[model samples]
Target chain A: MTLERAVAPAQRAVDILGGDVSESALKGYLEGLPGVDAVGLEQRAAGLGTRSIKTSSKAWALDRIIELIDLTTLEGADTPGKVRSLVAKALVPDASDLTTPRVAAVCVYGDMVPHAVEALGAAHGDPDQGLVSVAAVATAFPSGRASRAVKLADTRDAVAAGADEIDMVIDRGAFLSGRWGQVFDEIVAVKDACRKADGGYAHLKVILETGELNTYDNVRRASVLAILAGGDFIKTSTGKVSPAATLPVTLLMLETVRDWHRWTGEKIGVKPAGGIRTSKDAIKYLVTVAETLGEEWLVPHLFRYGASSLLNDVLLQRQKLTTGRYSGPSYVTID
Target chain B: MTRLTVPKTYKLYLGGKFPRSESGRTYEVATPAGEFLANASLASRKDARDAVVAARGATGGWAGATAYNRGQVLYRVAEVLEGRHAQFVDEIVAQEGVSRAAATAQVDEAIDRWVWYAGWCDKYAQVAGNANPVAGPYFNISAPEPTGVVAVIAPQDSSLLGLVSAVAPALVTGNTVVVVASERFPLSAISLGEVLATSDVPGGVVNVLTGSPAEIAPWLASHQDVDALDLVGAGELDWPALEQAAAESVTRVSWPEQGPDAATPSIERIRAFTETKTVWHTKSLL
Candidate 1:
C-alpha cells in the first residue's frame, strides 16, 4: 500500500508482498523484525489499563517519581527503640551513597509509634531533620476485625506514642455484611480517637484494603466513606493481601479525593502501598495525583507513597540530573 | 362489645421486619380513603441515621455483584411489580385521584421504565465513554462508575413511577440508594419495596423510608455518609435551608424539576444518572 510505504519506508518490501495480508498474520510475520525494543513491545501488549496522570514540563518531577526509592515494611511487630534506630540509620547513607533523599516515611505497626518517634528524632539529631515520621497503622491494624473499643484504644495508643500519621483499616467484613452504619461509626470513632491523642493528634489515614473490596466503584465509595468519617488520608492497602496498590484502584482513590475536596472544601490525602518498587511505579502515582487532583497535592502531606524499595530509583534519577549519568548508589541506613 | 375498633400504628422497616419506629414516634399519613394506611412513623433524625447505616452496610456486597446479576435482580423488580401491579394502581388511584385505567398505566409505565434502566446496567459504560487519549506513553481509559450511597427523594405525586424513575438510574450505575419516598404516597413506595424484596434486588440497595421530608431531609442532606441527593420531590422545601444543609458535606443536589410526565421521560432523564470522564495519554520518548 502507498500509505504503508510513505509511513515506514523500511517496511516497503513487506508492504509490496502484503497489501492484502490480515493484521494478525502481519503481526506474526513482523515478529521476526529486527531492532524492535522488546520492552516497548511488551508494554504495548499489556492491554489498555485505565488511570489518570498529571502532565509536567519539568523532567525532574517525572525523575523524582520514577527514580526515588523508599524502604518500608508493614510486616511483624514494631518496638519504639528498634523503629527509632532504623529511622536514624536510613537518614544517613554510607558508601553507595544514593544521592537522593531517603524514603517518604517508615511505616510500622501501631504500637511502635513511640519507637519510630525516638528513632526519627535521634536520626535527625534535631527533631526536624529526620527522613520520615512514623506511619503507624492502627485501629486493630492489619485485620481491622475487632470491637470499636479495642480499635479506638489501638488508635489512641499509636497516636499517643507519637505516630506522625495513623493508618486505620476499615472493617471490610462489616462493610460487606451490609453494616455501613457500623463501618461509618467505627471509622468516625477511630478518627475521633486519633484526634484525642495525648500530644495533639496524628493524621488519621483510613486504609480501605481495596483488593478485598473487589471493584473500582466500591473502592471509590470506600474512599468517600473514609473521608466523610474524617480521615485526613485514604490509603490503598495494608500490604497483607494479594494484588496490592493497583493503578485502577489508585485512580479511583484520586477521583474520590478530588470529588471530596470539591464537595467538602477539605483535602484528604492518598497513600498507595504494597509492591510499588520501581521508580517508574512511583512516578505513575505522582502523575496520577497531579493530573487527577491538580498540582496542589504533589507534597507529602497530601500525597505519599507506601514503598520501601522505591527511594534508590528516585536517587538514581536525581543523581543523573546533577551529574550526567546514573551512578553507583548506596542503601540509605535507617535506625 | 368492647367498642370493636382499633388504633393505627406505624413502624420502621429493618432487615424485613416492621418494628415501632426506633424513636417510638408516629405521624399521620391521611388517605383519600378517609382512613390512615397505618399511621406512618415519624422516623426521627436518629432513625434516618440508622437507615443510612443499614444501607451502607448492605452497599459493599450489593455493589460487588456482577452487572449481569444486578440487571437480573432489577428485572426481577419489574416482575414483582407486575404481580402486585394492582396494589400500586389502587394506591395511586386513591392518592392521586386519577382514573383506574390511568393509574394502571402509570403502574405499567413504572415497571417498564425499570426494565429499561435494568438493560442499561451492563451497557452504559460503553455508551457514555471508553478510554483516554494520553499524550504520553502510558495506558488509560475512563468508565462511568456509580457514586455510592445515593439519597433519593422520590417525586411526590407520581409516587410509583417517580420513585422507580429516580431510583432506577442510580441503581443501574451500581450505586446503592436510600430513598425517602413521598410522605403522602408512602403506601405505593412501601409496596414497591415488596417488589424489590421479592425481585432479588439486595436488601438496603433500595431502602424506602416514610417520614416527613422536611424533618428527615436535613439529616440525610447533612450526613457525611450520603454522597448525593435527589431533591426532585421536595415540595415546599425551604430552599435556602436545604441548600445550607446540603453544603455541609457537599451532597450533590439535583433539584426537583416540574413533575415529570410519568408517561415518558426523555433520554436525558436517563443520561442524567451517568458521569463522563475524558482521559488523555501519550508516550514519552527519552
Candidate 2:
C-alpha cells in the first residue's frame, strides 16, 4: 500500500469522532486509559537516553532533526521583522550549505501568523517546491486560562491568517481538577476552529503543559484525551514552564502514541519543546521515538522540536561533521 | 587486628563534578617501584567532547566576571590549596618518587605559582592592552580578551608544579581549560580538583582529566569548540600531528620554550591563550 493509503485509516478514525462525543463518554474513555508507572517510565527513558549515535548516523540524525524543528519564537516582544527573519531562517537554515533541509514549520504567536505566512510564501516562489508551514500557538498559550469562546477565536484567527498548523494549549486547571471532559471539549472546539473557510484545515497540536499536570498518569490521560479529541499532535509543554519536555515525559507520550496506534490505528505526532537546546538532546529524543514508537514515527510529520536556539547548535554540529572544523554562533543567524 | 583499606577512585573532573569517564574505562597507575597506586579514569574522546561542552558553557560566566572578581576567585584557589598542602605533598611523593622535602617544596612552589597568577588576573590587561593612535578621525583602542576554551597537555615531569603552572595562567586570564593531567603522576592533579571544587573557581573553568596524553590529547586538539591548545605537558608525543589536528579548527597552538625557559612565568603565557580585540569608533565633533 502507498503512504497516503496507510495514513487514511488514522485520518478516518479522527473524522469518526468529529465533535459528536458527549462529555461523560469522553470522561469514561479518558478515565479508562491505563495509568503510567512513573519510576519504570523514567528508568526506561534514562536507559534509552544512553544510546550512542555516532559519525554517519549522528550526521543523519542532525539533518533529520533540522527537518523536524518547529523553529519557534514565542516572546511578548515578538515583532513582524522578527517573524520574517525567522521565516527566512526556516526557508534557508544554512545559506552557506545548500544541502541543509528547511525546517518543518515556523512557529509563532497567533498574532504573528500573517507575517510568517507572507514571509514563507515570498521565500518559496513556486508552490510546487513545498513552502514551509506556519504553525501558530493559540488558546491563550502557555496558560490556557482564557474562556472557550476566546480560545476558539484565537485558533480561528490564526487559521484564517494562513497558519498550516494550530498549536493549542489545554486548560491545565481543568485537567488537574478532574475536569477531563472540559479539557476534551476545549481541544475539540479548538480543532474545529482550525478549519478554514476554504474547507482546508490546519493540523491541530494540543499542548498538555505536562509540567503543570503533576503526574505521569495525568500526562498519559491527557495524551489519550488529546488524541481522541482530534489533536493531530500532542506536545509536552508550552516552553514556558520549568521541567518542560523531559526525556521520561516524552517517553510516556511516545508510549501513548504507540498504544493509540495499536488500538485505533491512528498515528499522532509527539513534540518535546523547551530545555532541549543542544543537538545531543534532540538526537536523544529521536532515539526515544525510534525505540518506543518505531522508525515510522521518526519523520517530520510524526516528531518535532519546538525549539529556537536548537537549530544553531544543530547547524554548528553539521558544519563540524562536514568540514572537520567547528563553526561559531557568529556564523549562523540568531533566530 | 587486620584493617580494610579503602582506596580512592581517581575520576575525571568535568563541569566541577568528579565523574568516571563516560566510557567507563580506567587504567592502573602504579609507582615507579611497581606498587599499584590507583585506577585512573582512561578518558575517551567522548569525555573530551563533554569537557569542551562544559568549558564552552562556562566561558561566558567566567569571562564576564570582573577582573577584580576573577582575581579574588584565583586567590581563593590558592587558599584552598594551602589547606590541602600535606595531602598534595604526600601524593606527589608517591607518584613522582621524590623525597619528603622535595615533595613539600614542590607543593609550596605550586601554591606560590597559583598566587603569582592570581595577581596577574587584573594586571595582564593593563600591561598588554594599548590605545592605538589611528590617523583617521576615529578613536581606536586594543585590549586583550580570553580565547574561550583552551585544551592543555599538563607537563609530565613535575606533575603538581607543572600542572599548576600550566593551569593557573589560563584560569587567571578567564579562559576555561580542559587539562590532560600528568599520566604517570595523576593523583596530585585529581587531588587538585578537590581544592578547585571547594574554591570559587566555578565548575568547568578548569577541568582535569587523568589519562594518556596520546589517547586524549588528539581529541582535545581536534575539538572544534576548543579555541586554543597548550602542549607544555605533551612530553614525547608526536607534536606535529597534534598541531596539524589543531590547525583544522584554526585553534591557537602554544608550545612552551625548550629547557629552562619553559618554567619561567611571563605575560606571554597569558597572552598566548588571549585574543587581542581592537575596536574603532568615530570621533564626532558636536
Candidate 3:
C-alpha cells in the first residue's frame, strides 16, 4: 500500500482533533499540550523509585515484567542462528523453571523477522498458550535519516515478512526543527504501511528518540504528536542514544498517555527502551506506570521494556527468590 | 589565647567511602578508664547488607588483578599505615588504656603484619596449589581461587593488630572483605580505613563497619551473597547459632583460635577463603 491509500484513518484523527492537519495547525496542537515540570518530574520519579516491593509482590512483578518485555537484539551482526536462540529464550526464559511466562515479543531488525517468526512457531506447539509476537524496528531504525519512500518500504517489508508489530523511529531532526507536520505525516504513513491484505494492521510503536529531543517540553510535545498521528505505542528511544529511557522521561511519557486517554478516551501504549537492565529497575518502571496511570497499564498490551540483558538479571533474581539461593550469570544464557 | 581542638567523627567505611549509617544511629566510645573518645556510627543490618553488595561488586576486578598487582596494593596499604603511624598510636593509647610504648609497638606490629601479607600475596598460591599425577593420559592440577565476598568480625581485644590479622589474609588472596570492627575499640579501625582509602586498594575491596558484631554478624553470616564468614571477633557471643545460620547458604565459617596463636600470620588463614579447583584434560596425539 502507498501513502495515499493510508490517508483516511490519519485524516479522521486530524479531523476529530479539531485541526486542519496543516503544519501550523499541528504545531499549535503540539505546542498547546501541557509542558513538563523538569524538577518536579524528576523528584516524583526518584521518590517512586524508592517504593519497595518485596517477596510475593516482587515475584508477581517479575512475572509481569517478563511478559511485558520486547526481548530485542538489534545489532548489525544479528544472524539466523542468533535470532533463533533469542526466540528460544523468549519462548522459555527459564527452561528449568516451567512456570516462567513467555515474553510479549521477539524484537529484531526488519531482515531477521522471518527467522524469529519461524523459530517461535516451531517452539510454540500450542499457538494460544505460547503466542509470542515478532516486532521489527523499521524507518531506518536507530537513525530515522532515510527518505519517506524508503522508510515506508522498510515498514512494509517487515509487516510482509511476518512482523506482528512495527517499531518506527521518527525523524528527530524534523521534530526538533519545528517541522511537526512532516514528523506526523511520516508516522501516519508508516502506520498505513503496516496494513495487511486482510484489513489487519500491525501494531505501530513510534520512537521519539527522547535523548536527542533535549528537553522535557519536547518529549511531552512529541508524545502528543505521536498519539495524534496514530501511534499504537509511543516509545522513548531507539536504544542507540546515551540518555535513553530515563525515569523522568518515562514518567513524562506515561503522564502524556494518561492525559491523552482522559482527553480522547483512546488508550495508547508506552515502551521505555534501553538502560533498564535489572529486575529492580523493571519493577520501578512498573510502579511508575501503575501509580501514574492505573493498574490497567500494567498489562503487556499497555507497557513494555525494550531490553536484552534485562532478562538474564530478572531470571537470576527470580531463581534466587524461588530456590532461596543466590544465582550467578553462568546458569543463564548470555545472548 | 586557647585554640579549640576539632575532634573526629568515627564513621563506617563502606566501599572505601566514609558514610554515616543509613539508620542514622550512633553510639559513644570511651577509653578503658571511662574517658570519652568519640561517637562512632552504630552500623545497622542494612549497612552490613550494603557493604556486602559493595564487596561483591569489587570481587571480580580484585580477583582478576595480577598477583603482583595485589601484592603491590597490599604493600601500598602498609605504606599508608606507616604514614599514619602517629595517629594510630595516639588512638590506640587513648582507647586501650595501654602505655604509649605498648601502643607504639601495637601500631608497628600492625604495619608489619600488612607487609607480611603483602609478601604472601604472590607466594600463597604456589604454597597452596599442587600438581597431581594421575594414572591416565591426562594433566591434572589443583589451584586456589578467591571465594567471592567474605564477612569478618574483628577481635574485641588487640583492636589494631587483630583487625589487621583478620582482614589482610582475605584481602591479599583477592577476596573482598566486610569487617565488623571491634565493638569496644573501633576508633583505630576507622583510622585504618583512612589509611586504606589513601592506599591503592580499590573501593569495596575492604569495608570497615563500626558496630556490635552481635547486631551485624547474623545478617552477614546469613547474607545470600556472602561466600564466607570469619568469626574471629565473636568473643562471648554464641558461635553455634551463627554457624547454624551460616549453614543456610553453606557459607565457609572460620572461628578464631582460642590461644595466642590466633595473632599469628599463616597460609591457613588465606586458604580458609579460597576454593581449590582441579581440572583434567585428555592428552592425545593428533
Among all candidates shown, the one with the greatest TM-score: 2
Question: 1 or 2: which has the higher lDDT?
Answer: 2
Give the clashing residue pairs of candidate 3, or none.
none
User: B167-286, model 2: which lDDT tens digit per residue?
Assistant: 888887789999999888888898999899998888989899988889888878877678999998775798888899999878999874355345556777888889999999999977
How displaced is residue B55 in candidate 2, in Å? 1.7
The local distance difference test score of model 1 is 0.66
lDDT of 1 by residue, B88-107 (tens): 88878867778999999988
* Shift of residue B225 alpha carbon in model 3, Å: 3.2
Candidate numbers sorted by DockQ from highest down: 2, 3, 1
Order of quality (lDDT): 3, 2, 1
Quote the B-chain TM-score, candidate 2.
0.95
Better of 1 and 2 by TM-score: 2
Cα-based RMSD of candidate 1? 26.9
What Cα-based lDDT does every candidate model obtain? 0.66, 0.84, 0.87
